[model samples]
Target: MDSEKLIHKITEKKALKDSKELLDYVSESGENTKEYIRYKTLWAMLQTGNEMDEETINDGYKAVKRNVKGRKSSLYINVVKYAAIVVFALLGGYFIHFADFNNEIAMNEIFVPKGNRTSVVLPDGSKVWLSNGTKLVYPESFVGDFRNVQLEGEGFFEVTHDKDHPFIVNVGKHRIKVLGTKFAVVAYPDDEQVKAELVSGKIQFDIHLGGTGDNYKSLMVSPMHSLVYDKTSGKVYDSTIPDGFYDYWQNGVYSFKDERFDSLATKIARIYNVEIVFGDEELKTRTFTGTLSVDDNIYTLMEAFKIASGKPFEYTFESGKIYINK
Candidate 1:
């Protein structure tokens, strides 16, 4: 295909007959490769008008052969660049897409560093707010029977309603299945427990059970309720949580009701991107009940703790860590 016509088809989001050739042409551009990449990625968005039906395109290596009799195009594979809005997901800032050359299948990933947050819009128009120290993985497009995503750390999702395409979030051995729901997930790989809180819509929390791993039980979660599953014991703790507690960190406000300082240290570390050490074990038992703004300096927060405790304790910063003592 001529470069001009090939480029024109892409702008229209049409299926490509020679996807490999397109990549070769792009790679041969040398110094202009970056520009070419940006150009192609610019049109990555799925369009509404004059759109090529997805069934016309063959994606992935096996998919090409499976759909050979019905294929209209070879493969419509496009590279995902940093900060590009993809038909799969609107990934802003630092993001990476890994693909298999044989198959047009690409796995997209986004990481939010400590002390930061990112918001993304999926192709289905579902919105996700990723918390600091979080990583989310999804495909270049929703394929097969379900829309699957892997989440590590924490994220808040306002999922678009799609009865046919159920949105499923995989966190370790568990899964949160929903059809148009608002929820928050806390499932850091390093943590001993995983939690899912439903904000508005309903969700089904699937917990892996039995020794063989095939046995499982699904619990329907209602709005304003949270399910915390302990990793080792396989215990699920169901409780009611305040409406705004799950998403308050997005606004830089940390609210809690009589939560222990030590219990909250790990979250604080993620917010401030620092390590917290308790020099005095006694101080860890002290519970705090209030709201804290991320805008406050570390010292101001320590002072607030001092006021809450009604006594003077010592806090020092050293070795990129904060040490609190009595």
Candidate 2:
């Protein structure tokens, strides 16, 4: 009889009258037919909740024994293997653990560039939102006396308070220490400065910078205050700022009061990932003071700048790059 006819006959029988006859039929059957019988036999055993005798088990497995040994089995063997795995899992004798997880230290740094934003949790349980063009370097595992992290560019931190493990941020030569505080730091290397603007909670700064003898000169930041650091001059300027300044990163609209054109363009370049070229030296020196919405596209922002300054400007976009002309 053909394999299909044989399978139909096997399914029609409840139990074979003779074990030897069944084994002989399985041995003569094709791999597919043997697999089908194996599945039906296993399912029958499970439904009855009765363990088969050694002879009956051995006869049923013999049909698919070669496939199982070679890891070439069909649905029957797969079902059996998965059932065994589940049994082992429930027994708690074996479980997948950290040894299977990644243990290697992450080597590369993670950066969130302009016009893009990202959120990540640190090893110290602190949550950070990385702004565009921001670079954060942290170890895969934080090991040491204190939980410390390094940052370049800009980011907003919503730190998890842990009295035992104080959080420290290393930005350039300065160190910002806090037990728990909500703060934002804008420290771009090419920008020639770093600004730590605090929204709430107390923060202390240890300025490695000289000429700042007193703590008042070195550290003077409170709620709604910004500590501006000039890398070239080694000076710190603490100024009172309104609460809206903190919302600029989230809202994508910045309100500048007497902000210089050079400074504003640097921010624009980073946020839009574009280059602003102005041949007019006078225009370059002109300071812009107003509320500008960074949520707008490059063209829209350029229009806003033109309206604010009345300077005719033009721009074009390339592969992941933008160029401006006047």
Per-prediction TM-score to the true structure, in the order listed: 0.73, 0.61
Residues 1-326, model 1: lDDT tens digits: 44344555455543322467555554454433444433343344223211122432223223434433432343222222111233223222334343222244345566767766656555566777776688887664576778999999998898999889899999977899999988999999999999999988889999888566656789988788999999888888999977458437456677888888887788788877778898878788888888776566877887778788855688888877998888
**Colliding pairs, model 1:** 60-104, 61-103
Highest-TM-score candidate: 1
| Residue 175, candidate 1: C-alpha displacement in angstroms | 0.8
lDDT of 2 at 121: 57
Q: What C-alpha lDDT values do all the predictions have? A: 0.67, 0.59
How do the residues 108-177 of candidate 2 rate in per-residue lDDT, one tens digit apiece?
A: 2445556555555565557777666877765434555566778888888888887777777778667788
TM-score of model number 1:
0.73
Q: Candidate 2: which stretches are off by over 4 Å?
A: 1-108, 210-218, 310-326
